[model samples]
Target: MTAVHGDPILTSEEGPIRTTEFESIARAVDRETEGVQVELIGGRLGVKRVPDGDHGRILNWLLLLLMPLNPGLFLHVIGQGLAVGSYRKGRARPDGILAPPDAFAGAGEWASPDAVVMTVEVTSHDSDTNHRDRVEKPIAYARAGIPIYLLIDREAGKVVVHSQPDEDGYQDLHSYAFGRAVSLPEPVGVTFDTESLKDMGD
Candidate 1:
């Protein structure tokens, strides 16, 4: 479990846990652990493994492609926990959050999604990648009104760009294999090549 994307491990029927209790649990895990990230999505707890070297490489590759294209925007990782899902109740920490610089200023752990234009996720090697990255996330990001949800699916060996968010999920979708290029829609106008991912290992 070395990829950046969180591995979804749904908790057993622990009955109904309050938001305060969920936050307390997440804080304890984050404080005591070293290479784990906790998320409270859909009222269930999920643990994310520490990112491996390939994950770091992909992140750096993204930086090279985005910096020159959008100087006014920024991409945040690790510490940028987002308030996702309906009513901003669910907490999610994406691989990278794209927004204008200073969007998270004064926003503590879980920030609002108002300024978030895009959210990026890099799939891990775990079997839960399909459920977590492909299914749950699209709904959560859309519910949060994030304009774009970028899925770098390592297993699928493709880049799935989700945009045109509606109440349920993204209305528009375009997928490109590792060797192809990707074009993101507006509010975030940028296009890039994903050919280098061919060597990144699925």
Candidate 2:
């Protein structure tokens, strides 16, 4: 991650509180404070605790399952931010994001939502996290015109594949339990195995 200069002071009492600007947040994301994830929702900043070990296991499994089918595409795990909307009103970093390798070749800091093919989010322990991933993200992803949004709801013990994006969110949504397989749509024509996801409970 490249260092971003220009410190914008948010408060007089605190020294240089980071601004909600996408670039500022992106620059602030570093190894020293990797546990806190930053996002721009409706042009406002929203922070959340990163997912834990079990969340990572499921993400890894998904990466392994998808990478082989489309070698030209790149699968980005947590930390990479995606800029969405015309005004760049929102910047979201999904649990997993799949896009063409050259999509952001020369771009700096973030990738536009138009370049994204798919996004995945695994539900976390917090209700706010659940609401963001489950409800907010789908709407945002759809409005931004992403083709697919896959969500692994750990608390609900199910996997949901959302596609056919429209003005009002995904037109198609398919839900399956942990052991069932969910078929991805065109551009990524494959069935994902959810058997291993059962281990997330352990």
Cα lDDT tens digits for candidate 1, 34-114 = 787777666666777777889878877886788789988887775688888877677888999889889988998888999
Candidate 2 lDDT for residue 162:
96
Worst 10 residues of 2 by lDDT: 6-15
What is model 1's C-alpha RMSD?
Answer: 3.2
Q: Write the per-residue lDDT of candidate 2 for residues 55-85, one digit (tens) a residue.
A: 8888888888788877877777846778763
For TM-score, the strongest prediction is 1
Give residue 114's error in model 1 in angstroms: 0.8
Best by lDDT: 1
Worst 10 residues of 1 by lDDT: 1-10
Error of 1 at 14 (Å): 12
TM-score for each predicted model, relative to the true structure: 0.91, 0.81
